[model samples]
Target: MSKHSVVIFVSQRNSLRSILAQACLAHLGSGRFLALSCGWPGMLADAIHPAAIGALNSASMPIPNHRPRDWNDLARPSAARAEFVITLDETTSSFQPRWPGQPDSALWAFPDVAAAGDPEKVAHLAIQMLYALRRRLELFVSLPLQGTDRAAIRSDLRDLAHMR
Candidate 1:
């Protein structure tokens, strides 16, 4: 049996954070699990987000062909059932996906690093987002199936999203 299949949700696929998480998880996660990113049909067809690509390039984790996530990708016949659904968008606070089984869903919003006017500013934000998502994912993967650890992980993940 597979550990878990997770799908990540975001607003647009033209930016850094979601794409970075998709790229990172795809690289770091190996084939033990599956990771995918989905955004609304609001992404620009510019290959990849430039700053995001640059940041990944700097980290030596380049994903050159990341496009927007479509309904076909989300509701696919060959797609494995997702064990967890995580949303990583600021505008997705009320965003509820229509997953088939309605698996355990959570959100972990981070600032959009790609929108900063200054390159340095954007770079800093991207670094922050990368680390934040990495930490959250670490916490996510370490969550126990049952017991106090599971409760703690659930609470922390909610706090990461709802602690506004």
Candidate 2:
């Protein structure tokens, strides 16, 4: 049987881009990939942004039930070892934590939708981010992971970061 990869999408706050990526991957990757997400310590929110939830709902994606988590929480010895770690914002991309198993990492930078000052603008950005993330994830799930080496997988992921 082929191995199922655990991928963690990380960001500064885990309220927008990372949350969208996690939901998109979980729904799209299904049996092939397990999706998780986290943010920097002390940056977690009580809940994900409402715009994020609305975006997922519009796309018919599954909404995550849990609150935001700190990256340190996932770094624990007992935590599920991630095979892939992707950062979705500049802050998180600059702060590298030693993930368990030294997961193949990539920086898929996306704008912070939660930072939009207007509610309508926030919702619009969230939808845009959702579409962008879904496009990348669609390509991600189609990769020949079972046959590809770690280096190739890492390269492919980084290449996706360049996609709009």
Strongest candidate by lDDT: 2
lDDT of 1 by residue, 1-164 (tens): 24555655454553566787777776666554467766655453345566777778777875736566643467465666665566676675464456765556676767666667898888777866766676666555555543446446556657656543
* Clash list (residue pairs), candidate 2: none
| TM-score of every candidate relative to the true structure | 0.75, 0.96
> Cα deviation of 76 in candidate 2 (Å)?
0.9
lDDT, candidate 2, 29-70, per-residue tens: 867888999999887777899999999999999898779989
- Which portions of model 1 show Cα errors greater than 4 Å? 1-4, 43-45, 76-78, 145-156, 159-164
**Candidate 2 global TM-score:** 0.96
Q: Each candidate: RMSD to true structure? A: 3.4, 1.3
Per-candidate local distance difference test: 0.62, 0.88
User: Residue 70 of candidate 2: its Cα lDDT?
Assistant: 90
lDDT score for residue 79 of model 2 = 89
